[model samples]
Target: MRERLFAAAERVLAREGAAGLTNRAVTEEAGLAKGLLYSHFADLDDFVAQLVLDRFEAIAAEVAGLPERAGSGEVRENLTGAALALLGTNGPAVAAAALSRSAVAERVRQAWEGGAPGPGAVEEAMARYVEAEQRLGRMAAEVDGAMLALAITGTVHHLRMHGSALPDDNPELVRRLVAALVTVP
Candidate 1:
């Protein structure tokens, strides 16, 4: 039942945006009794909150699963591929929905603290990247890996929000961004 609710929420979020979701929409989409939503969730707010948490968990898993390319020659390729994969999910609606609720924000925060990998996942990836770069003599020894990771993640997130309608799963821009970031100038 929770799975059904989440599936409905995911579809509605992707297709209609946060502003368009309602308990009725979820129930209808799930093809469940209208009361099922209320039973599982205290209210529409609860449903949306859980949905946001679920998304964060999903995104974190995706990031954490990226193959660790430590000690590889294509550091940029690996990092960018991971970053793009994490950011390019259909997320505008999820972001909008999260913006509407403190519960969602709190849940996201907790997940981040737990190293779930949605937001902080990028930072962890960067740390790995910076370590790789240092090992390869690409970045300066004293460079802040976490800060660079945040910057790259922010840039990628913004690009995902505003860039051209490229395929979400394609890693071309990710590869390019990674190349630009780690290349010794």
Candidate 2:
């Protein structure tokens, strides 16, 4: 039920933008009762915050495995894969929705700051992977792993939060950026 509502919210955000987001719209889109959302979440703000945080958690969990793949794949593909993971399904719209409401945004910010998984977790996971690859002689010794992680995550964050297209929509674009950021060993 929660996932269904979240997906409905994503569609609303993507098609109607921030201005049109409302509990009623989300419920209607989900084909659930108007008050069904309230029954699940404390309020609209809680729903929005959970949606954004849940998405971030999903991406972070995926990137958490980056270190394990360090020695097996091409560094660019590994790193670019992590970057793309950060931009999960409907990322841009989800980000826009989070930013559209002050209460929701603050709730997410506080939850992230409180150490729940979020954007920083993705960056940290990538950095760990870079360092692991560096130690394995899979990457150049001169490259700063943390900066590389930042570059990839920052660029991905931009695309996730500001881009109109999904990362999957133009993976080559992300690959290009990742290529530029990662050095050949």
Where does candidate 2 have its weakest 10-residue lDDT segment? Answer: 164-173
Per residue, candidate 2 scores C-alpha lDDT tens digits across 26-113 of 9999999999999899999899999998898888888898899978978899888888788776888888889889999999999999
Q: In candidate 1, residue 18 scores what lDDT?
A: 75
lDDT of 1 by residue, 1-185 (tens): 88788888778877887776888888899998878899987877777767666665666566664435565656666677667656646555666777667776676667667755466665675677677677667667776777768777877766644544765534666666666666552
**Model 1, CA-based lDDT:** 0.69
On lDDT, the candidate that comes out on top is: 2
Judging by TM-score against the true structure, name the best candidate. Answer: 2
Off by over 4 Å in 2: 164-170
Candidate 1 local lDDT, residue 74: 62
lDDT of 2 at 143: 84
What TM-score does each of the candidates earn?
0.75, 0.94
